[model samples]
Target: MAPAHRDLADIIITDELAKRASEPPDYLREKLAFRDLADDMADNPKAVLPRLVRLAMEACGAESAGISLLEHEVREFRWFGLHGALAAFEGTRTPLDYSPCGVTLQQNAPVLMKHPETVYGWIRSAGISIPEVLLVPLHLRRPAEDGGAGTLWVVGSEPGFFSLEHVRVLTELAAFSSVAIRMIQAEEVVQAALQEQEQLTREMSHRIKNLLAITDGMLRLTARTATTKEELVAKMSGRFLALANANQLVRRPFAHDTISRVGLQQLMETILKPYERVSTKGLDVALGDHAINSMALVFHELATNAAKYGALSRDEGQVSVGWSIHDDRLEVTWNESGGPRVCQPETRGFGSTLIETTVRRHNGTIRYSWLDDGLTAAIILPLSSLAR
Candidate 1:
């Protein structure tokens, strides 16, 4: 998805989650400090998990920092928070045997080691560069026999970086974060689980909403089909399936991850597959992985409608789906001919609704004109929205 469309509502909602994605946690201390009082933080561990972790990173004097959680299935270290580091590491997991953090975690003890010569063997394999390194384990309170209290902290840096004093200060800070880490981790687990439930609920709701809408459409078709409603309903159901299939292309578990770049040719082929028997003889559609999902949905619906009523309905129809980049904007035009004359839809229906609504969301423009013999829709989408 383009960076701009990454801010879509669906993406925004999930972005608020407390996953242990890799990021330096301490980068947001000032903001966290201002947002909550010490008392409030004390009262609410989950509320301050991000802040506490952020604070811990600041104390360590590390340019990049992150939290790692044990994945339930494999017991591997999964990064949760990150700061001043590569974003690609977000949600990426490292093997327990492969990670130094994993070593400290398993021993339930902090391992402070900084040897440039021996370090590259393990850390470099993870694509992380560090001249010196410190590993601290952040732990929750256990029975007195289970190593009473202390959190392990891991610090890695370019060679010859941290002095003993720096490690000392980091240790002191970890003392405070240790307590906070336990509270925060427990709270995050509950919150994350609850968040998953809520997301499932919302997705189920969206599915139910789609089902009801289709059911209602089917009922309407049945009522009107006293003579041919069944066949019409069947066709409509197939069309709806096509729409759903198109949606699946744009709908991912993570909204920000949706709207991938796809070739124009592939988009039309998928949507037009159901109606290719009637038309598509001379259609030429080509696109690089430049198209986003929202735009693709609009294209899909347009093609579906064309196949059912306009240019694609006759043996003489041809569709040319192509787009050209112009001044940082993309202009995709769909031209069709060789079919019966097109009559503008009498009343707006599902296809029109999808094209208009989805395009408008991304600040795109859609213009449909019925020519003497066929239909053409010119869609202009800001290149900024489709930019990676």
Candidate 2:
């Protein structure tokens, strides 16, 4: 069996941490100097992490400065942020167990190493020759099982280059970094929650408007049929029930389905089921949601007019509704037969106007013919309108 590894504290001190700890008064003064700045930087890790490394390099007059975060899953130390001579090394990874930063993490204290390339093989591979280094562990408020987080370090090109004062400065910076990281994390959580709430609000508003539009169309169609107040009330009640059923199906949430498109066959059956006592058939072509929505209003107007004056007015009357795709355009035909003699009205009514307007809105064309037996209506919708 391999021998157990020794604790980091037992291997290397070199009088660096002890020398800094000996001067408590000077260290306390340094902490007091940056207390306000630390408070101000606590909410911005992006700004604070980079500034901390820059300040460490400036204050200690070091050749390079950086912070390495411990990636537990890979057992590597990635340069989270950097400044000064080694700025290009940001995001580079080093072996966690065999570097000076690892020693600082394991000891949970500051460590000073002289001629670190002798111990860390990555330094030699990268052609970096740091004569001395100072690293301070940043213990974040994480679960103990995570083994905490990272280290802040400064490097020098000459032996015994980093003094006790440099260690004190880096330790103070690491403390501020821990608070900044926590604050940034909390801010991200709050921002995400707010975004989710906004999306839900927008969806609710859209659904309300859709319900209102459907209600208005039903009211207009029902008004055209009823001559007396009692007839109006009875017709409205039945139409409202049909509207409710169609709305329920259209508004249902489904994976990979959006509000802009609905099933063509399903919509027709929902709206026409009330008038099915008279033979009604045909709507087989596949169309998109936008086309379906516009067509729903058109069909509602056509069906309402037929029930009042056309084929659906009599028990023996029949209606045929179907669509065919031809050369990048959809042609939908509505035929009514077996009722009273058909004649064109002297003036255009709301139902006729509604059908025309709805078809035009979807970039489609409509034609009406008052034949001797029945009314024939044809609508042509271009496929380009439904591409999206």
Candidate 3:
């Protein structure tokens, strides 16, 4: 019951073939090659490409090598790397058809000129120099959708330097490296576009908010006129123009976090300029460029009322408006003296509503007191809302 010798031999051959098939693909070999190339290229790209030029020459067993890349902006060929006597070609640019690499790229294939001297029949007509050439297309996938077909790699020197094995390896590596370059370029483009879109969105939001505020201010100012119905209509037309002016100031070519503090002061003064003729000699008004927009509007309306009926209406009356910051808020005091005896109004009007709304929007509080001689208004506004 012994087994035949042929059966044992067949069993051994089958086991060996199965073991070979079970072994992994040579991914480790490919990874090691890529790591070595990347390490060599880490320090300086100019040196890396040039040294790659020399290594390619050694791999082909050639006397020299020249490497060129396509520069589509110039529609020309440029020598990016060189080895040995051909090193002078580095940094040189020439028309596409006048360079050997140009033909490889245009044809989308490899070119091997076996005879150095006799290839001139084709070379001479194209205005190219031929002394033995091995040109390979560095075929890259498009960097962006609009990119041209790949790049060209020209390696030329003495004759018969490129073996079939050398051509195969170089072509494969060039294809992979070109795609990596295109990927890097695509990521940069996407990042830039995102940054620009974010900036535009912020600016648009700012402009829309400013326009709404201006329109609301104008409507309130118009409803307060009490001269005659005919005069009231004329006053509204003027208020509309002032609103338009303020809108133009806020929307301009550059970015700013808030209206300029100095500009806010001037705008407030201009808004109340018509009331300066009030006859009170002792009436004093003091404000500065440091006040914010919400506070500015509140103080402007209070001044207008004083000129019409409070301390500023008579020569012997006196009034003062001043502000100072304390703790987390700003405290403003409006005091009057020597005016007619104070009394509370039975109904609130447009002026009262404007002042209340502007201060409340900033989360501020206001109190008005009627004393025997005059009216006093005190305001406290949080600094956090007004600082910027």
Best prediction by TM-score: 2
Angstrom error of the Cα, residue 387, model 3: value is 3.4
Q: Model 3 off-target regions past 4 Å? A: 1-210, 213-231, 234-293, 315-318
- Give the worst 10-residue stretch by lDDT in candidate 2: 1-10
Local error of candidate 3 at residue 332 (angstroms):
1.2
Report the lDDT tens digits of candidate 1 across residue range 89-154. Answer: 656666666556655555554444443223334444555554344555654555244332323343
Model 2: lDDT equals 0.71
* Best model number under lDDT: 2
- Candidate 2 vs candidate 3, TM-score winner: 2
Ranking of all candidate structures by their lDDT, best first: 2, 1, 3
Could you estimate the TM-score for every candidate?
0.40, 0.51, 0.40
- Which residue pairs collide in model 3, if any? none
Query: What are the per-model C-alpha RMSD values against the true structure?
Result: 16.8, 8.8, 20.9
Give the higher-lDDT candidate: 1 or 2: 2
lDDT of 2 by residue, 1-388 (tens): 1112334444354585444432233655556547755765754555777777787787777889988988889999899768877888889988778888777787777887766655556776786766678888876775365575888888876765777767767877888777777777788777766765666567668766865886687577668866898987876665556556555654424322244345556677777777864344454555454455566667776888888898889888888877777998878788888878889999887667767877887788999889876889998988777542
How big is the positional error of residue 107 in model 2, measured in Å on the Cα after superposition? Answer: 13
Q: How many residue pairs clash in each candidate?
A: 31, 2, 0
Supply candidate 2's per-residue lDDT for 343: 95
Question: Which 10-residue span in candidate 1 carries the lowest summed lDDT?
Answer: 5-14
Error of 1 at 252 (Å): 4.4
